[model samples]
Target chain A: MSLTVPTSTTLVELQDVHLSFGSNEVLKGIDLKVNKGDAVSIIGPSGSGKSTILRCINGLLIPQSGKITVGRTRVDELKTETERIALRKRIGIVFQQFNLFPHLTVLENITIAPRKILGISEAEANRHARDLLEKVRLEQKANAYPGQLSGGQQQRVAIARALAMRPELVLFDEVTSALDPETVGEVLAVIRDLVREGMTSILVTHEMRFAEEISDTVVFTENGLIVEHGTPDEIFSKSTNPRINSFVNGLGGRATPLHDGEGI
Target chain B: MSIVLKQERAKQLPFGGIFAAVLGLTVIAWLFLNQSLGQVLLEWLPYLAKGFTMNVLISILAIAIGTLIGIVLGVMELAPFAVVRAPALVYVQIFRNAPHLVLIFAATYIFPFELVIFGNYVPFPDWVKAVVGLAIPASAHIAEITRGAIQSIPTAQWDAAQGLGFSRSQSLRWIILPQCIKRSLPPWMNLYASITMGTALASLVGVHELLHSANDASTAVQRTDFTVVVYLTVLIAFFLFCYPVSRFTQYLERRLASR
Candidate 1:
């Protein structure tokens, strides 16, 4: 598909966003940007606020203070649930738990949002859903309930369900974390294909090697702050920061030299 | 494993044993009565049957009305605003804890016997008042059941629906309530059985239900043995009606748990 906006255009920008739950601060003065069609990955340890950033970008969590601009809308200024819902409609998010509606068949899960919110005809919605089912390589499971599918298959259906909205950007929150080890690859492969198709994506994930392989930019966050961000090569292989080197080496189990232009 | 399965199956429905016990007691009572048992039963069966039908009708009407209002109250209990939620919580708490017989009495005396409709005085019958009386506790119990069922749903479902851009009302209508119905079914059936048994309480208010009919039969017969047989039949009648419902609820609970 052709790019709807110029590749240089910034699709999402967060300026010094800070959010807290009770007294527990999660995101502290964080700034991030995603250019149109760029696949950005945020990686961090548990409780590092990586997933919280994705939630904030999609208006699921509003920052206590700061500007979040997605396309033309100011997310922080969204005063009502109606405005938040409007913002959410344009952005799709896949949860770590793959929260497919257990009561719905896979096809119905994929088609419901388009038919209900977008006012698409049933036939058209089904047609689109079938196409998504094929893209996710689960065409035969369209009539099956989510309970009948494996974890990986359920996550794939969740992705299709999100894509059915034709969202401008999609957020993936550790989409493979809940999967059985053997099944995680299938979900990741589906996401890899989506990234290759030039979809603008922001992912919060723990799959270190996959992030290094797919991300246009890799962001490392620790204790509710972004510690470092750069191209995958810079963050993974060339960064001199002891913490970044330790995190990458510790998670990925790679022994690449910390200095630029140094061999393994 | 086979022994465990047998025990589980044995625990599920003891209908045959209950039936045998009722039959044996009735036969013992018949032997003691010294009159033709079949003849006495044949004469009183039609009247008892009419009263039993009234019991069934009341149960059906009460459950239908209670379910409708209870669902609304259940949803209200979860409303974001305290103004909408507080009254619903108060209603469920008061009615649910109150005695069923007391509610029946309250409904009997509190509501005016006549209702003015279009300037016409329409007499509200005693049985209809009994239905309203029984419905109060039924609605409160069902409201609690509905709330619990909705809460039992994983919050992930709500998040998914919201992330997909479905409004709160739309999510409840399309996604949440459909699941709630399945989860609520077994308890709802259990409530129905309770309400069916509670219909006997209506007898105190002159509703002419099964117990009332049995009371009249005993008084008119003027024999102690005949009274025992009459009241025993009333007990058997209620057991026969409600036992199956409880069994079916168990069946549903098992099916849902497996799924």
Candidate 2:
């Protein structure tokens, strides 16, 4: 349970993090670090605490006992709500449900936080939001309400909304899992482009091929602990751990190919 | 040919016109048959209208104050700590259960006329007392609506807002409250219309609103025969005012639902 002062290159570090929900222990002593501009993918079976890690990182859920650092901010040690909000301002997350405000038009959904929290001028916020919409290939749907758009389109808008803040780090919690099989490609394409643009991200994804293609570090969790941590190649083909091997085999994919099938 | 065109034609149809015509004819026939009653009605219309003005004023001020009180209390009811939530729950329960007329009486008679703050006496006007009385029950109803509407929003929205770096208050203001407004509007309008009708209770406390004005005018005329006309005018005035609120609430409900 030693605390490490994350070096300059490490943008996020979780040291000995422990969290529980009443009788259920969701995360038991998780330690992980992501270097700046690195794409880290956390892949695991359901109930293995992959999403819980992302929630703790985003301050949506606080750890029972641990140290979490993003850049210089000690997230768990933040004393005031304002301080936590300041810390959160530097981070963004896109959820599986594409939680866009249904009552607002897509443009408004993207512009709200920047205009309200950052006190950015309306014109400037709109300009930035439009640029993000362009990136997600959803500029055409900017004026449409979330309900009118297809699931993939809504998820794209959500990604755009997260990007509008210009966050230093982004977390994607199974961003494409809820989409129709055909639509999943478009949403994943958006995330792929963001990774190419060097957005530091921690993605909790079941898309095995996509994760292997983008992740600089791959973490495998089971029973509320990290059972395997390595580069994509090491974790996919080189790791000899029986648990990691069985989990990869359970996905119905050969570890060497990495793109054997859809998802676990 | 087009749906819009069909809807426009539907709007042009005089669906309610026949009913209105029949009702109007019946009232006119009654007036003509009782010529002296018709004359008294004409004489008392303006006096009753003046009292209706007082009702409108009381409703507006009381609703405004009540909504503010409701928003604060509702937020308190959602507070994470028991120290803050317990008192707010108690406040909501007490005010919501007490009858509007009872609150009006309590505010008018039992409450102090003046407060000594820092050794200075601040006098309370009778209108202010009546406003307080009307606001109590209205505030409680609004608080309940606010609490329910806010809770009804999916938890995912809260997580999304938090992920975007919003504090609890900022999330409530920018995200939660906007959605709550849509969900809460119809019931809120219902509460308002009822409160506006509740302004009649202010008459018992002697605030001289619509009913009080009608009572004074009827006494002056000294004819129990014209009593029907006096009370009927007051009833029609209220109907004219409240019917629109109900219609607007329906309109908004449909509009929001389409979203």
DockQ of each: 0.63, 0.63
Best by lDDT: 1
* Candidate 2: stretches off by over 4 Å: A1-8, A241-246, A249-264, B1-25, B111-125
lDDT of 1 at A49: 97
Cα RMSD for candidate 2? 5.5
For residues A226-263, write the lDDT of model 2, one tens digit per residue: 98899988988898988777777666464334323433
Cα RMSD to the true fold for all candidates = 4.3, 5.5
Question: How much lDDT does candidate 1 score?
Answer: 0.87
Alpha carbon lDDT of residue B73, candidate 2? 88
Give the per-residue Cα lDDT of candidate 2 at A156: 93
Deviation from native of the Cα of residue B167 in model 2, angstroms: 0.7
Error of 2 at B73 (Å): 1.0
Highest TM-score: give the candidate number. Answer: 1
Q: For candidate 2, what is the DockQ-based docking class?
A: medium
* Model 1 CAPRI quality: medium
Q: Model 2, range B46-105, lDDT digits (tens) per residue?
A: 878888999999999999999999988888899999999999899999999998888988
Q: Any runs in candidate 1 off by more than 4 Å, and if so which?
A: A1-6, A254-264, B1-12, B15-35
Error of 2 at B24 (Å): 4.9
